[model samples]
Target: MTDPLVLGPLLRHVGETTASVWVQTGGTATVTVRSGERSWSARTFVVEGFHFALVLVDGLTAGESYEYIVEIDGAQVWPPAECEYPAPRITTLVKDRPTRLAFGSCRTSVPHDAEHHGSHGVDALRTYAMALADGEVEWPDAIAFLGDQVYADETSEEMREFIGTRRSLDEPPGEELKDFTEYAHLYALAWSEPANRWLLSTLPSSMIFDDHDIRDDWNTSWTWHEEINETQWWHERLVGGLTAYWVYQHIGNLDHDALAADEIWSLLAAGAGDSEVDLTAPLRDLVERNDRHPEVYRWSYTLELGDCRLVVLDSRAARVLEPEARHMLDPAELEWLAEQLTGDVDHLFVGTSLPFLLPPGLHDLEAINEVLAAGRFGGLPAKGAERVRQIIDLEHWAAFQSGFQEVFELVMEVARGTKGDPPATVTFLSGDVHNSYVAEVIDAEQHGAGSRIVQAVCSPIRNPMPKGLRVAMSGFSRSLVRPMRWVASRSRRIPDPAYPWRVTHGPWFDNNLAVVEVRGDGLHLSWYAGEVVDDDHDHPRLREVSTVDV
Candidate 1:
């Protein structure tokens, strides 16, 4: 066996009574995983040039921590001699508990220093998260990675150098990840750190892909697709992007129930499935079709963790982009989401890559951009609108007005108790915009229980907004957006008790990590960001930016 590329060793709830441990490694080796005296072993095989395995040990209780090890290739490969690349031992998931969840997304793997990190600002968020995972602090039950788990479009200088080292950057698609091998290596680089990899193995993670995971403005519009197809390398680019995405990210996010119920899964179960499920060919076809017809096979899934129900929606890929009746969630997906939102759970957490709610001014800006694309404001040439969309990432929820409206209505209905008693809270967790903030829809007339609704926006676990753009976003939200919002509210309001005014819980402009804890009835949320104290890189301190009890 060659050097093992171990992944996960995660604990996930299989049923109300059973739990499973998931792992993916590099070579064919006997992997012995132990929770105490009892142990289970599985033989991991390298298929499609990637090592993978799943071991299910039943009869484990929820909310209990179990310590385990991985022995591969006749050696204890976990808990490495040096805490460097390729992570250490695995731990059990935070099974079945009303617990704390740490979630934020849009991380780029730049260095931690300010000037040395190649223009992406200091990776304070990564450093802080790594510190917490390395036992500098307590670990959260689960970490929800909202989106941009990787940026396929924007490659840092270090990444370019690494890719250029092995692969020819002068090829068809250049350094922007033209194939699956590049994507695999990118994931390795992203998760190779001992602390971060161990953190993922221990904490149960749920994720959804965003535009950057594929390419910038992946599905901004049909016109964008047409223009991309016009490029010589786009065929390979799309195939590689979607194929690697399915293998590296999407496959793990599914539960047994979801997998069994999926069309592709059913085919695999029948043994009539085209290539083996783990191989590259099947993934290539499904992902290719997914990119070609974004709405054909839905990538969305739901998780019922005790009393908490997490509905992670696929805002991208499955978009219904017809102008007459558009939506982010197609009718079928909307129905499925509405069914899940019966609010039988204590807290309803909706995870999507893009926030359903954006700053009203930004929302208006999107509408204007759309209108301009239709040639109202002398839009770009024929493919001008598509080009502009790619430049500014115009494929957000704001762009898909109908789908955004549907999800918003669904959330509002759930919050208002359409099925059972209203949930203690209905929180939308999102990360896409490089900045993070908590915005609450409030009834200005009264505060407290009569509040409209709460939406928490956390983003860029590592990436920080550019300085000038951050300043502009702040200025627009404060100066221009505030007054214009008031005037617009006179005509366009979200009905009585649903006053659309937004009160930000905190300020922005910091690379940060956020945690949300549900204790008793109220939900306590806190934001933490790292502050550099010295050039020696030892005195990094994590200070609380803001706290709110909603």
Candidate 2:
């Protein structure tokens, strides 16, 4: 029999009474998910010749551990026959149990061998897998991959070699992904490592895509959209990127209610049978429409775990590119986000790919750059400023002032107990800055006895920023921007932030992964880096870089 399982069997959306498992198959097959005495089976659906199934297993008791087996057409294909480690188990959330989550971003797909260690470093996720396998660390409730899950635009040497065997590298956008098939290969390369693969199978995961998932600086500006749309291959690239993301990442994110309400799933359910349903045309059209009009479909989601709420924002796709009214999240998305940012929970975790609270100096710089890029200086200077914006990646929350203020005010309101009973902490968990840091916002008026607002950033799970760039960033954030802030405030004519903030921890540049635990009224965060101790590259060790409590 053919190897039906291609990718996943990834555990997702584990709720009180329901759970979802996503898997890719080789052909039309019955995908079965078995947990204890309960089992659910569903036939795979086809999209652009790729077979996938999202089996929702019901009747699960909350706070219980259930060992699961995935089978395709009556043959056990997961938890490999020769496996020595513990079998994959789904542990549902318990009401009184504290919530622990692992988060990081910007992982590159490269061989784990010692030769590639210098370029890629040891994969922190892989090392975490080793710790989990050995029972050295407690498994998190879920792993939130903030963004940059796959670098579609930046292919590695191995990826290039694989592309060359299948397609000509001389074509436009050569070496980068051109279609769905290439993206499939990219995901395979990213998740196929033995240790990481096992970790994914058992652990619940949530993800969002950043620029690299499509192309670098995706939707950075109106001009960027125009330029990429003019490219001959962009149509296929956009469709493939989004469609694959839905199949591989987005579907599993929804709870039972949301999944049942989804239009695409409704269509797929209507056509479920022995034969695979061809959804290429409809799926492509959906992606195309969503690209042009982001409000047509929502990518952001919220999870209520115990006494905390995790709000994962889709900062990339839900953008308003209108020059005069530019915002990271469009009106509909903004409203949705506002609804989710309530004070009912003990801890409010806002997960955005780009950080909400950057270093004050850096934030000032970006805000100033935004005014200049808006033709404040006019003519060639404005043009140059625009180019600089793209070059230095200035398209963050601070660059979009209106959106930044709106969200900031809302967060402040929540923290001040204006929305409801205040959370103990309102923490912004983010990645993509290539460095890890913690910053706390101090309310000028000492508002209410509400939440302590903090920004915690952990990034580059495998990729590392260059030393020169790190030095420059540290220097600019430390001293240079202090003077620039005065000029920026004067030029932009915007008042100072109501609350002043300072970086309290880090600016560390190690390839790292971070974990956050929420207990009662306190939160603990720690960063870990993978180290090849004793020259055993295969069995890399995880070293704790720093830990902070708030």
Candidate 3:
């Protein structure tokens, strides 16, 4: 029999009474999810010639573990007989249980062997998987992949070889993904690694896409969008990227209620119990419309676990690119965000792929650069500044003054107990800077509310920034704050940040994954990097880089 499951049995949206298991099959097959005496089943639906299913297993008891098996066409296909790891299980959330999450981003699909190790380092996720399999570490409630789950624009050597065998690399966009088939292949390469695949099967996961998931610096500006749109292959690239994202990443993120409300799912559900439905055209049209009018659909979501709430923002797709009124989140998204920012929980976590808070020095520089790029100096100087902004990746929260202030104020309000009973901590969890760090917002009044604001960043589950560039970044981060603030003072266009902050923990450049555990009113964060202690690539170890408590 053909291997029906290709990409997942990826456990997602696990709750007190329900669990969602996402899987891709080789053909139209009946997929069943068995947990103890209960079972949930669904038939795979076709999308661009691929069969996929999200089986929602209900009637699960809260705070209970249920070992599950995937059966395609009434034949068991998952948890292979030769598997060495523990049986894949789904644990529903308990009301009194503490919130624990593992988060990291910017993982590239490449071989885990030694030759690739020099460039990509050991895969931190894989190492973490080993730890989980060995029962060396507690399984987090969920793993939040902040961004860049797949590098659509940056192909690995293996991926390039596959692409070359199927299509000409000399075509426009060359090595980058051109269509849905390539993206599907890219995801297979990314998640098919044995250790990571096992981890994904058992652990609940949430994900959002970064620029590299589509192309580098995606939606950075109107000019960038216009230039790319004019390219011959960009239309297909956008449609495929977003469509695959919806099928693979976004679908599993939603709860049963939200999934039921989704129009795309409704369209697919309509074709169920019949011949395989080819949703390529409708899916492409949905993506195209969402691209042009981002406010038409929302990607941001929030999940409440115990006493805490995790708000995952769509930083990339929800951007407003008007030069004069640039904002990271469009008005509708910002309004939605405001609704999510309220505090009734013991802890509040905001997850953004790009950090809401940068190192103080870098923050000031980007804030100033934003004004310069907006033509505050006018003519060629502004043009040059815009180029610099794009080149150095200065576009972030600080670069959009309105967005920065709006979010800052909202966070401040939540912290101050204006929205509800204040959370013990308001933490922003992020990745994408290719480093790990923790920063705390300083409260001038030494107020209890002010003490709760913090930022935790973990990045590059495999990719590492070059040592030379790391050194340069460190020096620049240290030296730029004062001068950039001084420059901002002289420009009417730039405004000073309301709350001061400092990097309290790190700027570590190791390829790492981070975990945050929230207990009652306390928070603990730890960063782990994969290390090949000996020459054993198959059994790389997870070494703790640092841990901090807030």
Candidate 4:
């Protein structure tokens, strides 16, 4: 019999005593996850013509592992017909054990064939999956997909074909995702790859969206927003992206209690037994509401991993772009984040889609652009600066000087033990730029801050920058450092960063995944890339690119 299941039996939000399993079904049906003699089931909730269920499997033993199978409407559909890999397992977190996490961003869902490999590079997550299957590395406690898991604007050939079947490609937003249906298709393309799917099933994963998840340079500035709002297609794109995100990614990130507390989720889950309750109207309205008032909902959340704390922030949304207050995060989000930054953990990790500390060279350039766009020169030049900012991707944490200063001061306070006992390592985990690296923070006054503050960036788990662009980036990181800093010094408004930083390990431009282990009082970081052995284009072996113990 054909499987009624769709994208996942994805393991999400595993804890010491519980785990959540999320899935999409073909129709209105009950989805059950069974392991040994115990089983848990949830009736699918329908939304945007799709059925999904996030089952909270309780009574799980701490620090123990269990293999599970999925059944839909009482028929075994998962571990689909002669599966070769190990059965999907959930390994709950131990009380004092440090969390091992794998993270990366910017993957495009293209075919994994030779031609695609030539264009996109080897898929790092796929290579990691194959390596784990062969027992080459330890499995991470979780994987944080920082952003760009699906590129709605830069549609792949497969996505375009699927889009064409239901909607004309010659429309206003040609080759771009049109509505909730198309966004659903895009998620399927991203997650349904055999090896990657198996990996996600066995490994608990969380995600946050970045610009490309909706459109290029999403919410970059007031100018960008005003321009896009005038377009015929922007509203649909925003609605589709946020709606699909809520159903597919955001809901799964919550724990049992958190999920139950969610307004839309609780409302939809109430209709579970009724079988695929049409959620089209509510979902559309919710997305529209969020677009107009981002402060009403937050996509950011946190998890406590033994002695380490992980805070995954929503950097793309919850932004304030008005001329009087340009911020990467709105006041509400900032206040919430301020409260979360208090420390009593061994290591504190902030997972954001955009890096907190960009390379010094790149950081200075963005700072200069912020002042230019804020009318430092004149109206005409400010207009030009806004256009240039979008063209060059200058919208980063450093671009909002006031917001950057405030957050920098907050982090500095945490490092100095103002909130509580300072953590040994204050780390920022991020990805967006096509390259990867580590940068260590330095206090200007030479004060002993008592924490190893650093940035660990990993990007492009699949997509690689084109050669010319790679060359330009490399030149910027090296040749333009001094010149950029010199330019930034002219603007009194762009003050020196709270703490200047320098790249320590890499600027490697490889399709890569970075694994970080919270080992005692420090972080053990490693970056791995895929190397094709013996011209085997289909299978790439994991190769260690760099390792840093901080």
Estimate the TM-score for candidate 2: 0.98
lDDT of 3 by residue, 9-74 (tens): 899998888889999999988899987677899878878888899998888889999999999888
Clashing pairs for model 3 are: none
Model 2 spans > 4 angstroms off:
none
For candidate 2, write residues 250-303 as lDDT tens digits: 989899888878878888778866777887888899999999899999989988
Show how many residue pairs clash in every candidate, following the order shown: 3, 0, 0, 0
Q: What lDDT score is found at residue 225 in candidate 4?
A: 92
lDDT of each: 0.66, 0.87, 0.88, 0.87
Give the alpha carbon lDDT tens digit for every residue of 160-268 in model 1. 9878887788875676877777777677767765456666665567778888887777767767767778988787777777776655565556676665676654544
TM-score of each: 0.87, 0.98, 0.98, 0.97
For all predictions, the C-alpha RMSD in Å is 4.1, 1.3, 1.4, 1.5
After superposition, which runs of candidate 4 have C-alpha atoms over 4 Å from their true positions?
Answer: 443-445
* Residue-level lDDT for 74 in candidate 3: 88
lDDT minimum window of 10 residues, candidate 4: 442-451
* Candidate 1, position 484, lDDT: 46
TM-score of 1: 0.87
